[model samples]
Target: MGKIPTTIPRRQLGRRLRDMRQEAGISIQDAARLIERGAGTLQRLEKGEANRIRMLDIQALCQIYDRMDELPGLLELAKVAASKDGEQGLWWNEYSDAIRDDFELYVRLEASASKLTVYQSEIIPGLVQTADYARTLGARYFSDTSSREIEQVVTVRLNRQRIITRRRNPVEVDLLLDENALRRVVGGPKVMAAALRRLADLPANVTIRVLPFSAGFPLGVACGPFVVLDFDRATGEPPTVYVEGYRGNLYYDRAEAVAQYRDTFRTLQAVASSPADSKQMLRRLAREYER
Candidate 1:
């Protein structure tokens, strides 16, 4: 076991290994015995809960599963996962002390995603939040932390916005914001106004639509906030649904769960205002807030 945090590449590697093992019709216990390791250790590796992954172990498992052809890619994934320097290169890692492990995982996933479909019911999504809006939320959420620490959290959040603003192949973003998020004033009227204007003025890569109250429960129920992250197929990671909750967050990578969220998003999209109309509404709200 190693001390390094479980990373996205590590998790993907584990998932592929697990699938290969299952496809080969080998039980965990038998596979562990053949690899000269404990079943619990093999389980941890398959679950991506292992602190450190060994190349030798990966090779042994690949051999046992008769997946030699995949060894090269899996090995590469392992290299990336185990590389401390590579992990350090990520900008968010510098602020690890300011964020929770679950949040760190979310950030890593969000960074790698090629496309993002976000449905926010209350406050604005962090990726589009203005500095003041984010600072206000950070201050209350991190009430116990010092002002400097709160600032660090806010900085990390603003940095995340770069994924959509970056020059090279910026991530495609589709944001479905509930109208309440627009009407709800955060950080005072002026700050809220600025946040609305920012959303209305986002780059072409971002498509924002508002789900008005008149839509009347498009999904037939009150759905909370969730994000669907789709990665490049070359990464071998499945689409994921991130459900953020008060107590703990959940990540769903199973095909069925991801499909359900996607369908839900499409349904909401059908009822929501078009991107052009949404921007117009945002501008109108900003004017109201300015008054």
Candidate 2:
């Protein structure tokens, strides 16, 4: 078995470390000083970009944060992050070169999520996209790259859909697509028609609805694309909201922030067409595309 990416464990450890430091009201400089390390190093550790993590440093930080109760688990996570071997056979590793550094973390989180709630204003979400549709967007996004690289990117995306497509305990999906997504002629009308038909045929675990133009912005403001990832309690990871941007992505995990996004989703859901209606609408638009 090949070595798996330890990024997820590293990120989880980093989040816990940052949370503990904040909870204890310890400044990064102060904590770093006590740990006898540079502030930059501590920051990298908290960001999960640290290539090497020392058990002693983790213990000292735990002691300073008065979070000894969490020490054992933190140490275990640190060990895993620092180790060369991890779980085997994750497909993403095969296409690591195609994935952007910032987006890699989100992929890990998405794979681990028990449920996903998504909102897209202009384009179909990647998880639900057809191969040709994904390839079209991939080519545009990676215009400078070789065709092979673009294909790898598309493969990585299609692989991600497996989380929802797998037969055993597939992740539940609640996708809210703005009406504009349907009208957009991505990869031409033929591609759009095929994509919509696939969406209309999705399984029971996937609930897709369209927020029609008639709804006219239920929140009275345009909301960009975002995804909320809910994890199983056993993972000890908090629910996270991912906001993707042209330059960089943002993640919010604070309880209040997560709650606000949830409220926004519920509001949109109330106004969006019902799943049955949305399916009918999808088929209707698909037929139009066929014409």
Candidate 3:
């Protein structure tokens, strides 16, 4: 047999399937009948259970849901999920020792989001976090672990961005970082300086802005840090909000919660500096830290 690709994340297949099924408004029995599959089997797929995912099954499910664009990536991940080597976990599996189950779901949603807007309160957010910086936070805040494991997680965390950037249709990223996050010394001088420089260097598709301390506490202070995931499920797929508390991240698909966060985000943007000023701030921070 030809070698099976093993790079895919564990349960990623099921996660993607479940998200799409939920977004499409497909129920267990409805999807089962349309795909010529059993309801229990469909449930397992949606539950992130380990299973052999046939390309034909994926094709049928997508067609039933009328999601033609997702077919290619879905088929690719399915084949990898079925292969022997694919059974092995990605680098993220190591962190599962302390990571909450719901956070894993957040990671899955993050991977598939067409657009992401993050409001960071305490420190620099993960996507732009440098290796040393991520480790410092992981060691200090997360359950204790050795340096090697922390580094592995840092790698996976940074590499996960590849999912959006790699595709021909690059994901749109809007990062709103509080001014204090830039000032905080999570990893001390050297690491923080490097992280700031990296943040300033992000590409065109990625928009990084700073909510200045002068803005005087926007909506996020009460709400704290949250991630807003915008997906184009169909021609007009509304956005969703994902909030991570101390314990686990919660997915908010309810129209009311989504609407609340949406207005709050717009308020934040209006009060915060323009993109030009945001970049200027990052550049100024980098210069200050370099010294």
Candidate 4:
């Protein structure tokens, strides 16, 4: 029918719909029957993978979920989700073939995040990484990946960085990095040095903290690299935790899971060097790399 929605808003609407259904104690099969759609179709809608969503279907589902009070906002979100594709398509959609579906979802959330709290144990966080640094790491780990594909990945990484630097209401970034991240030479000393210097030059809205080896593996050590994205409360979007692994990414929106990650982040912030101290550390590391 109309241009099927394929952006982040659609996915978010689906997630909200799913949450409403569960809160109403309705099963997927029951909900599907009420909407006169097959179980698979209903599942797709709830998962945000549906190409098209009829406004009438959304109204009916909201009624079934007894969420009439939220109808106005839900309708608005649906309309935005179904609008012309390219007009509002996410920037990362172009690199869809190069990244996993879960990563695509993560990119969507990252775009809308009002604030980002990240703890990176390995290399520099993507939000602050330089192009050379990103390409170096990508080429090393994904040696089998074609040069063109690696470039696409690097391009996407650079675009993601813009989220924090955009002029209008740039997302506030709080980064907690492990000391080892600074010492490891990702793209040789020159690239590593440049990256470290770049961190030192971040805008006032960005905060970087280095968790020294002396910190001795806090609770977050086992968690690996995870990001906690907080959205505008007015949007009714709950805080979310995104954990990345070798295979794919895992998303956690459940209150307990989100809280655990938040707590870990706070703890890490305490143990890591203060922002001022971290910047100085970065400068020193850059000099070391230069030498």
Mark the regions of model 2 whose C-alpha exceeds 4 Å error after superposition.
1-8, 33-40, 63-70
RMSD of 3: 7.5
- Model 4 Cα lDDT, one tens digit per residue, 1-291: 112224457777889899999999999999999989998998878767677888998999989998999999989988887777533556666778767666777777777778999989988988899999999988987799899999988999999887777787888988889998898879799999999999999988898899998898677335598999988775566888889999877878889999988888888777889999999999998999899
For all candidates in order, the CA lDDT equals 0.88, 0.90, 0.72, 0.84
Best by TM-score: 2
Overall local distance difference test of candidate 1: 0.88
Off by over 4 Å in 3: 1-100, 234-238
Q: Tens digit of lDDT per residue, candidate 3, span 49-154?
A: 4455667878888887788889998887676556666335444555664445656666655655679888887788887788888888888765566777666667
- lDDT string, candidate 2, 148-234, tens digits: 999998999899899898988789999999999999899999999999999999999999999999999789889999999998786
Give the range of the ten consecutive residues with the poorest summed lDDT in model 3: 1-10
RMSD of 2: 2.6
Global Cα lDDT for candidate 2: 0.90
What TM-score does each of the candidates earn?
0.86, 0.91, 0.67, 0.84
Residue-level lDDT tens digits of model 1 in 1-291:
112233667787888889999999999999999999999998878766576889999998989898899999999988877778656567776888988876777887888888999999998999999999999999999999999999998999999898899888899999999999998888899999999999999999999999999999987899999999998886667899999999998888889999999999999999999999999999999999999
Candidate 4 lDDT at 91 equals 66
- Give, for candidate 2, the lowest lDDT window spanning 10 residues: 1-10
Cα RMSD (Å) per model?
Answer: 4.2, 2.6, 7.5, 4.1
* TM-score, cand. 3: 0.67
